[model samples]
Target: MAKKVALLQGNEACAHGALYAGCSFFGGYPITPSTEVAEVLSGELPKIGGKFIQMEDEIGAMASVIGASLTGAKALTATSGPGVSLKQELIGYACIAETPCVIINVMRGGPSTGMPTGPGQSDVMQAMWGTHGDHAAIALVPASCQEIFSETVRAFNLAEKYRMPVQVLYDEIVGHMREPVEFPEPGELEVIDRTAPSVGPEAYKPYDTSFGDVPPLAAFGSGYKYHVTGLNKAEDGFPTTKADLVDAEERRQISKVKNPTALADIESNEEYLTEDAEVIIWAYGSTARSSRYAVNELRKEGIKAGLFRPITLWPFPEKRTAELAKQAKAIVVPEMNLGQMILEVERVAMGACKIAGVHRVDGEPINPGQIIAQVKEVL
Candidate 1:
């Protein structure tokens, strides 16, 4: 059979990728710029024997996804910034309870109901720390419609593998932009499912510590009957106030995702013209698209500029950034927000290289000209 190629919006690609990644349940409320994700899934999931529910609000949508994931379904939900705020408690619940799920945040201008149709990257920090408490987060930012599709699949795979919620963050520009996306033929793309309990029901412990950092998850009705709660819990999954047990559980949750090996597995970035360039531009999402163009143009003019685009937002890809910092004389970060990710770059670069920020927040995207000017200024 010929490969399927379609001109799809970012939201449509996300839904398609979720389905291809074995997502069987979707629960989301309709929000501008992200509603298409729910709409697409609502129509497509039923045809494939999966389920889709339009919830009353973002909080309900988030809770529904957690419930679905508990039943061993690969569940997903889509929302924008305000919706993400409403979903925070449940997101934290999923973290503490160790439920595996995916959340897509098609970012719009923010704080309150800022701008529904405009783009913003202000949620970069929120994606890392919006949910209360200490827990590791995994967020993937896609630059193009095609990447949003592929990264959605990667998000589900990481969520299941790490037993946590993984977020896909794209801005309004990418979300509404339409482009041709070629999906892999069946069996061409690798799909990962959660590991089932190896022991008999009588011996199963949902949060078993004996196995390793990530214990296998048992389905809710699979006869395991393990307890799950937001309160700090023990290895058996029951809530506890015991300081020692609480401390241990928290550490395990952090370690599970932060383990060097696991972190390396999930980190992704793109490097263009960095090999011999003196100035490197750091960007993500739609901003990277402009930065890439600027870098190419600068290179042609005999200015040694490069581009570093991070796909994995959380876990920040600091190691790779630091490595590049060692080689480059200056680093320029252009983001749609008023400098959310630049702080991260500055921290990682640590005086190793001169760093500059190009920020835009008038509900407009940072263009290649703006990025090129910043690159020149820094040089």
Candidate 2:
């Protein structure tokens, strides 16, 4: 039997991926480069008997997602940079409250509505640090429309499994670009939901560690009433300022994603012809597509070149990156922004190899020719 496929835009793929992942609630306002995601869901969610709400603004959208997710619904929201800035506070709230939700941030030029049409990867760091306080973040960056759909599904899985917010960030190029996408059958792709508590309502706790680091979360109206707060909290989900309890809880939250065993399941990357390459291109999102092209071009010229693309952005893929830094003589990082992800590569490289960046922020993408030139210049 042949599977049905469609020439779908990246945003469209994301919407279908959410449905495939069992997302029943969508709370988002329309924003450029990402509007299609909400537009598609607004129509499709109702058809599937799910809920879709166009909130007043980005903040309200984020708030609604948190509320919906607490009721045991797989919730999601999509926005660009400006909208993301507005949702930062609520993003932090979701963090402290330990809710599971997915946020799709399509990167575009700007600090504040800079260039809506011009794609940018400047939001990479913000995805990790936009929210206040000390908390762990899981963010994914995919280069193509197919990856956008697949990674969006994975983003939901990570959020539900870890009991935290997980984000999928891509540039306007990939978000608006059209590509052939094969829809996964109902059971083709894995869908993960938050762990449910086995205990009766009388003994349920939102952040119970007795069930292990990630406690089972019971639905809000499931006859289980538990406190959730922005302030530091104890295991019972109530506020706690006690030094030992606060320290333990905070550490546990961050460690859940940072722990070696946990990180193995969270961090993802792709390396191309890196075994004997002297120059490696370290890039993500749309820039990585160009980098991959440059690697092929450089290899043709007898320069051993390869690409190391990060699929999971948050945990930073530190270990694998460090290994590549040591193996390669130099690494070239070209991004839509001045130089955001390059900073992380340098930190992990720590003088292991020479690193340089090719940056452009004029609402244009860095071309493969430019990446190849940088590789030669470094060589």
Candidate 3:
């Protein structure tokens, strides 16, 4: 097969990436900035013998995706910030149920429909904590259309590997921007399928801990009759009120991803000119693009500045940031929201370096000029 190159929008590329990753079902509501994702999948899924459903609301859409995922389909749902807010309960349900699904959140300014058509990174914290409880999350932040495509596939892989919901976080800028992308061939990319049960139907335990931290998931209607609920569950998948069982279940859920070995596999970060730099710009999503340019501009003027962009936002990539803080004099965080990620940077840097935030919440992206100025001030 010839390499396929096309000028694609970020949302469109995300849909394509889902298809390539063997996603067979999409249940989503149409919301600004993210509607293009549903629009593309609606047309594409049927042709590929998959299913596309526009649920009446965001809550229903989230529930439907989890239902489909239970049946062993690589399922997905796309929405903006407000829609994600509405989906929190079901997202939490998916988390506790250990369902594997991909959620694409094209962030718009928000406290409640704050800016439907504008960009904002206000959901950075929400993605990790919006859903109530002690559950782990995997969120991939992509800065470009091409990165969205690749990361969307990676999100599904991670979700299935960990048996939990994974989020692909992009903003209005990257979600709507058009860029040229050459998609890799099927053989060139790695596609992961969920682990299946090894034992007979009668011997199956959906949440079996004896097997491992992440037990094999049995598909619905796969001759396995099992129960799933939002309440803490035992190894057999039944809701448990026992203290020991509840504690064990919660600990397993959190530790599966929190473990250093598992976290290392899911985390991704990009460093630019940071080896000998005295200043570092910590950014992600579209803001990193501006931060990159600012790094180059400062380096040209003999300012030893670099960039540390976290592609994996949820695990937070604290290990890498801590390492950078030990050597750098200062770390400047530029974000679309009012210093959301800066808090995480501060916690990790731990007074090793001065931390400053160049924040914009008026629905405009943080530009290169703003980052350069902040870098100069911090120095």
Over the stretch 207-322, how does candidate 3's per-residue lDDT look in tens digits? 98778899999999878899999888888888889999998888889999999899989999999999998999999999999999999999999999999999999988988899
Model 2 residue-pair collision total:
0
Q: Give model 3's TM-score versus the native structure.
A: 0.99
Tens digits of per-residue lDDT, candidate 2, 1-379, equal: 7887999999999999999999999999999989999999999999989999999999999999999999999999999999999999999999888899999999998999898988999999999999888999999999998898899999999999998999999999999999999988788889998889999999787888888989999998889899888999988888988999999888998999999999999989998998898998999999999998999988999999999999999989889889999999998989988888899999999999999999999988999999999999998
Off by over 4 Å in 2: none
Order of all candidates by lDDT, from best down to worst? Answer: 3, 2, 1
Question: Which 10 residues in a row give candidate 3 its minimum summed lDDT?
Answer: 181-190
User: Which digits, one per residue and each the tens of the lDDT, describe model 1 over residues 284-356?
Assistant: 9999999999988998889999888999999888898999899999999998888888999889889999999
Any residue pairs clashing in model 3, and if so which? none
Which residue pairs does candidate 2 place in steric collision?
Answer: none
Q: Looking at model 2, which ten-residue stretch has the lowest summed lDDT?
A: 203-212
User: Which whole-number lDDT from 0 to 100 does residue 281 have in model 2?
Assistant: 94
Full-model lDDT, candidate 3: 0.93
lDDT of 1: 0.92
